[model samples]
Target: MNGLCLVTGANGHLGNTLVRALLGQGHRVRAGVRDIGNHAPFAGLDCELVYAELLDSSALDKALEGVQVLFQVAAVFKHWARNPEAEIVEPNLVGTRRVLEAASRAGVQRVVYVSSVAAVGHDGTALDETHWNTESENAYYKSKILSEQAAWQCAEALGLNMVSVLPSAMVGPNAGSLTDTMGFLQTVRQRQMPFDPGFRFNFVDVRDVADGMIRAAEKGRAGQRYILANVRSSPLSDLIAAANTHTPGYRQPVSAPRWLLLGVAWLQERWARCVGKPAQLLLSQVRLFHNVAQEYDITKAKNELGFNPRSPEVALQQAFAYLYRQAHQPYEDLPQAAVQTVSSSRA
Candidate 1:
C-alpha cells in the first residue's frame, strides 16, 4: 500500500490513463516512456519519466529500483508498424521479462499484468482464464500469449507475485487525443460503415481497467489471472445506434457478408506485407469478429477485485461522446472510417 509503482508505455492511451489513476490514488509512480524527450504527456502530473526499453535489461533495472508494484500495460499492433518483432514482441515480451526479473530481484510485492482477452479467447464465445488463443494467427496475439506465459512461468519459478488482467476491446477516451477505437466510431457517426456492426464484444472502461490493476495489486492472489469483463456487450448494430443518439442521424452497421470480411482480410494482409506494415484485419481480429460472443464470467473479479463496469450501451456512449466532444463535431463528416456509418442508401 505504501510503495512506489512503475508503469511502462506511459505515452500510450491506456498507459496515460493508468498513470493518472495511480496519481489520483496518491501512489508514487515511476513512468517509463520510450521517448523521454517528450515530457509533455506526464506534464502537470506527479510522476517520474525515464527512458526504458524492454530489450535493455540494465535500463529496465534502473527504472524498477524502489518500485514495489509493476503495472505492465504496454501494447503494440503489428498492422500499425512495419516490424512486429522490434515493435510488438521485443518490448512486450522482453520488456515484460526485464520488469518481472527486476521486480523479483527488488522483492516487489506484486505485479499487475495487463494482458488481452485475445490471449484467453479463441473461437471466442466468452472464454475464461482457462482458455488461450491459438498461435496460428496474428503476431500480436501470439506476443501477448507468450508474454503471459513467460510472466506466469517466472512467477512460479521466482516466487514473484503476479496477477494478470485480460480486458476486452478498450473503447474509451484517452490522452494524446486519440484511441484505436476512435476510427471505428467515426465511421458510425458519419454514416460511412460499409458493413453492418452486427457483432458482439464486451466492454471494460479504461478507468475500470485502471482500478482493476490496483485491485490486483492489493487483493489478487499471486499466480492468478482475472478476466476484467463487463456486465454487457452492445450488439455491433446497437453500438452504431448509440452513436446516432448524440449525432442525430448517424449511420449504422451494414451487413458486410462473412465472405466479404474474408476477402478484406486477404487484401489486408497483402497490402500490409507489400508496404511492410501490419495487416489491419489480421487473422486474430477477423477470428475475433467471428468467434467473440457470449457474456464473460467475471464473478471472480466482482467477488475478489471488486471490479464492475458500466453497461455496454453506457460504455459505448461514454466512448463516442468523449470522442465527439474532443473532436468538437456533431458526428457528421467524419474524415475516417472508425465505425460503420449510415449510408445515403439508408431507409
Candidate 2:
C-alpha cells in the first residue's frame, strides 16, 4: 500500500479524483491515460503520466512497471452506441481481461477493479454485493457485468490479488467530460427532458468512491466485491428538487407514465438511428427504470471498508455547482434558508 500506484483512465472524473486522493495520502502515482498530450487534467499534479491503452499489451506493461497497486478504471461507458458490441462490450470485456493479465505479468501486488452498481441487480429490495444483474438489456450495464466477471476469472486464473468495487451513479466535481449520469442531471436542470419517468438512482460522490477503492486495495479480501454507494435510493424528483433549491428558476418537467415514456423513448431511438447518432433517451434505460429497484445495502462496505458517504442531496448540490461553473454562470452557495427548506421538504 506504499509503493507506486498506477491509475488507468487518470483523466476521467473518478480517476482524476482518485489520483488527487492518493497524492494527498503521500503516495506516488503513475497516471495512465490514452492521450499523453492531454496534460490539462493533470496540470500541477506531481505524477508520472504514461500512455496506457487497455488493449495494448506493450502499453500496459510499460504503465504497470514498478507499480504496487493498479486501479483498472478505464472502460467504454456508453449506454447507446452505433454498435454496442464493438464500441462498448468488446472493449470493456476484452480490455479487462488484458489489463488483469498484464497486471499479473507485471507483478502488481494489488488491483482494484472499478465496477458499477449496474452489475448488481435489484429485486424490489436493497441489493448487496451478492446480487448479480442477470436481466439488464442495457449495453453499458452488460459491459460492466461481463467485465467484472472477466476480471475475477482472470485474477483467479493468474493468481493475482484483485478486488472489485461497485459504485453507483457518481456525481461530484473535477469532471473532465460530462458522463451519462452528469448529462442526465444537466438535461433535467436545463429542462430538456420532456418528463420524469419516475426513475430512481443510488447516487454517491466520486470522491467517496475513490476513498472506498483505496480501502479495498488496502484491506479488501481477495476476489471480494464491495458496493460503494449511498445507503438508499432516491427518486429523480429529489434530484430535481435539490437543483431547484440550489439554483432555482428552471421549470420542472411534469412526471409522465412509464408506458408513455417508453413509447417516446422508442421513437427517439428510431430517429437517432436514422440520423446515425446516439439516442438521448434509450429504451433500455426506460425498461430498467420500470423493472429494477435502485436501492442498495452498503452495510458490507461500511463494516469492512469503513465507507461513509455523504447524502445524495449534498452530492447533487456539488454537482449542480460544478455544472453551473462549467457554463460560466454565477453560482452562489445554497443559502442556509434554502438548505433548511430543502431538508424539511425531504424529511
Candidate 3:
C-alpha cells in the first residue's frame, strides 16, 4: 500500500492536489494521465508518468503494473451532453470497470475510489453514506452512482481492498480551469447570476479532500464508503457574503421564485442547444436548488479516518485569490498586507 502508487486523472483538480500530497509524503507515485505530454505541472517532481486512458482498458494493465495502491480519479464530469451514453454514462461506467479490472490484473493491494455527493441521495433531509442516489435523472449524478456501484461490485468479485470517498463540491487554491465548484463562484463573481435560490449545499477544500482520500487509503476500512466534506452546509447567501468579504462591491443575487428560475433555465437551455453547447444552468440544476437544502454528515470519516476539513469561507477566500491571480488581475480588496498575513498563517 505504500510503494509505487498509481494516481489516475493526474491533471485534474483533485488528482493534481492528491499527487502533490503523495509526493510530499515521500511516496513514489506513478501519475496516470491520458497524455503524458500535457503534464507540465508535474515536471520538476520526480514521479513516473504513464499514459493511461480508462476507456482503453488494454493500456491500463501496463499503467497499473508494479503499483501497490491505485487512486482512481479519472471520469467525465458533465451535466448534459448531446450524447449522454457516449460522453457521460459510458465513460464513467465502462471506464471505471476497466480500471478496476486492470487493477485486479496488476495485483494491486488497495484502491481509493473518488466518488461524489451527487451519487448519494437524500429523503428531504440530511444524508449520509447509506443513501444511494436512485431517483436522480441528472447524467452526472447517474454516472457517479453507477460508477461507484460498479467499483464496489468489481472490488468484491476480485477481492481487492477498496474504499470509496464521496467529496462534496470542492473549492481551494489549486482548482483547475474546469472545476464546477470554482465555476459556481465565478458565475456569482461576474454578476452572471441574477437571483439566488437560498438553498445550501456542502462544500470542502480541495486540499482537505485530497488529504482525506489519502487517509482513506491508509486507514479506512475496505469495502466502506466515507463522505469527505465540511461539517456544515452554507447557504447561497453565506457564500456570497464570503466572496464579498474578500472582494468589495460583489453583487449579491435577489431571491427568485421557483417558476422564474425554471423559465430562465429553459431559455438558457434553448439558447445553448442553438449554439451547440451545454447550458450554463440546466433545468435539472435549477430543480435541485428548488429542493430542500442538503446537509452532509462527515462524522464517519472523522471518527474513522480522522479527516478534518477547513471552513468553507477560508476555502472560498483562497479560491478568490487563485482566480484573480490566474487572470492576472490585482486584488484591490485583498490588500498586500492582508494577503501576506493570510498566506504566512496558512503556510
Clashes of each: 19, 0, 0
Q: Write the per-residue lDDT of candidate 2 for residues 1-347, one digit (tens) a residue.
A: 88999999988989989998998899998888887766667766777888888988878887888889999998887799878888999999999999999999899999999999889976558889998988658889899988898888899999998899999999987788889888888887776777767788888999999999999999899989999999777777777777887677766577788889789889988998799888987888888875345888999999999999999989888888788777773223312221000011100
Candidate 2 clashing pairs?
A: none
lDDT of 2: 0.84
- Give the clash count for model 3: 0
Error of 1 at 17 (Å): 1.0
RMSD of each: 9.1, 8.8, 7.0
lDDT digits (tens) for residues 179-225 of candidate 1: 54556666666677677624576766777888888888899988888
Q: Score candidate 2 by TM-score against the native.
A: 0.92
Which candidate order results from sorting by TM-score in descending order? 2, 3, 1
Listed in order, each prediction's TM-score against the native is 0.86, 0.92, 0.91
User: Model 1, stretches more than 4 Å misplaced?
Assistant: 78-87, 122-126, 177-179, 329-347
Runs with alpha carbons beyond 4 Å of true place in candidate 3:
329-347
User: In model 2, which range of ten residues has the least summed lDDT?
Assistant: 338-347
Tens-digit lDDT track of model 3 for 177-259: 55766788777666577678755767788899989999999999998999998766777777777767667776667888888
Model 2 regions more than 4 Å off: 329-347
